[model samples]
Target: MTHKILIADDEPNIVISLEYLLQREGYAVLVARDGQEALDTIAREQPALVLLDVMMPHKTGFEVCQAVRADEAL
Candidate 1:
């Protein structure tokens, strides 16, 4: 099965590069502009891996990572 990867970052440049790299590696890509959106997407999409930015609006990457770890599905 193809793995799903989430790219969570407020910076367009970083998102673009990561999306491209992940896609090139044959993984499905999902994107979020902020930490809250990342968490929501992670819960909904259950991405196999999350590429998160440390500094973002609403919630930080650390917070998002914590939430993901706390979530049983992820």
Candidate 2:
């Protein structure tokens, strides 16, 4: 199966580049422009991996990681 990867960053260029590279590598990519969106996408898509930005808007990457870890269902 093709694994789904989440790219959680506010920068458009980085998102585009990463999406291109990952897609070329045969992984299904999902993008989230901010931390809150990242968290929501994570819950909905259940990506196998997340490439997260540390200083995103709404919530930091640390906060997102903590939230994921805290949630038993995730």
| Count of backbone collisions within predicted model 1 | 0
Which number leads on TM-score? Answer: 2
For residues 1-74, write the lDDT of model 2, one tens digit per residue: 99999999999999999999999999999999998999999999999999999999999999999999999877
Q: Positional deviation of 33 in candidate 2, in angstroms?
A: 0.5
Cα lDDT over the full model 1: 0.93
Pairs that collide, model 2: none
Question: What are the TM-scores, per candidate, against the unseen true structure?
Answer: 0.91, 0.97
Tell me which residue pairs clash in candidate 1. none
Please give the CA lDDT of all the candidate structures: 0.93, 0.96
